[model samples]
Target: MQNTPENDHEQDAAPSKTRRKKDMHALQEIGEQLVELDPKKLNEFDLPEILLDAIHLARPMTKHGARRRQMQYIGRLMREVDMRPIQEKLDSWQQVSVHQTARLHQLERWRERLLTDEHALTEFAEKYPVADLQHLRLLIRNAHKEKAAEKPPKSFRLLFQALQATITEV
Candidate 1:
């Protein structure tokens, strides 16, 4: 057959081998992430029974080669499944976790500042007007004493929990 524009266009319509490989790898990575999910969370995804069985089989695998083969099989099965919802759910969970982590860091900074800087308590009261300044002050004092005595950080934990409550309320 002669090389024609129509034939060339038809050929170009298919994805390149490199692109196809990348897609398969991406799906495989998604499968790996799915396998790491909690069993309850995994059930939230309407995955195929075969794929679920494959994932279950992979969970107890101790050997490298067997798990690798199972993962590859899961990837192949993923090709037939609509991956959009699964990807979206994973993305949402990641975003929530990131936000929660950021919030925890912010609270930790506040707690450290409260412990080290006397002025930080006033600043915190100013920022979170609803905060019980007296209770916070007492907790800070106890936390200092606990640290000095090298005791368990009961007050320290209480301060964090208090901060968590105050910040969350805001």
Candidate 2:
């Protein structure tokens, strides 16, 4: 059989249709993710008013069917807006969250070291030059005493707070 122009056009259209479907699915996934975000975080994105309203409306939807339908509506609205800025903001928020978690872990490690090792305080003060060496020393000593006496961990909490503040300022 001869390859006609009509046959070639049909073949090209088939791939385009599939690609459009994939794009729709991707937009729907982004919409679903937005719905799952807390309202405060959701407000960080520069979204269309209609899409933002849809998202807010979906939040109170307890019934699964209704929520799903609302999400589909959100996805439809998303297609009319530029998605690049939204995606970039989401990516940056995730990165900031990850950085905060890592910082918290580092502070915990420092607290543990201060409690377990005598030299840890010197190392911490050296690393965090702005830290009040004398205050940290007092807290660490009190925390150790509290641990040995099996008393409330007031000093331990204070030490952690001081470390957090010092690290955050840096």
Candidate 3:
């Protein structure tokens, strides 16, 4: 029951093994996420040649066992590279996509309000001083006419594009 040097060393070794396992599993999960990414987006990450080759090979793998083995190989390769930069690049890519989605939603909301409410134009112009109020008015009128006639939403699409441009410019 007495504290001993051997017992202290055993305690230290136990945590190191557990930590290594956890780190390995986390790396494997990251590798799996990398495999799921679009090839174009995957190319943006500066992965090692071996890991990149493994990912490319895994992409066409149909059999579950082959894919799993490839993923394990990718994880082992990942351990050789510094993961912090790769993690940061992935985080930034995700954030950019999220921001783009939010911006699209905002533009859609503005377009909807412009179609349904008369006061929305004034609000939009006030919020975006650089926007072309005259052009927006024309598009809104055309969009309303298209809606009444149940025609194709060409003007509505244009209005959405204008809104997007104006919002992004600001």
lDDT of 2 by residue, 1-170 (tens): 67899988888777577788898888888898898899888888888888999988988899999988997888889999899988888788889999989989999999999989989888887888999888988999999899999999999999999999998888
Off by over 4 Å in 3: 1-3, 13-21, 38-44
TM-score winner among the candidates?
1
TM-score sort, best first: 1, 3, 2
> Model 1, poorest ten-residue lDDT window?
55-64
lDDT of 3 by residue, 55-166 (tens): 8888889999988888888889998989998888878888999998998998899999998899999999899999999999999999989989999999999999999899
Per-prediction TM-score: 0.97, 0.79, 0.84
Q: Residue 151: error of model 1 in Å?
A: 0.8
> Of the candidates numbered 2 and 3, which has the greater TM-score value?
3
**Tens-digit lDDT string for candidate 1 (1-170):** 98999999988999999999999999989999999998999999999999999999898888999988888999999999998999999999999999999999999999999999989998999999999888999999999999999999999999999999999898
lDDT of 3 at 161: 93
Question: Which of 1 and 2 is ahead in TM-score?
Answer: 1
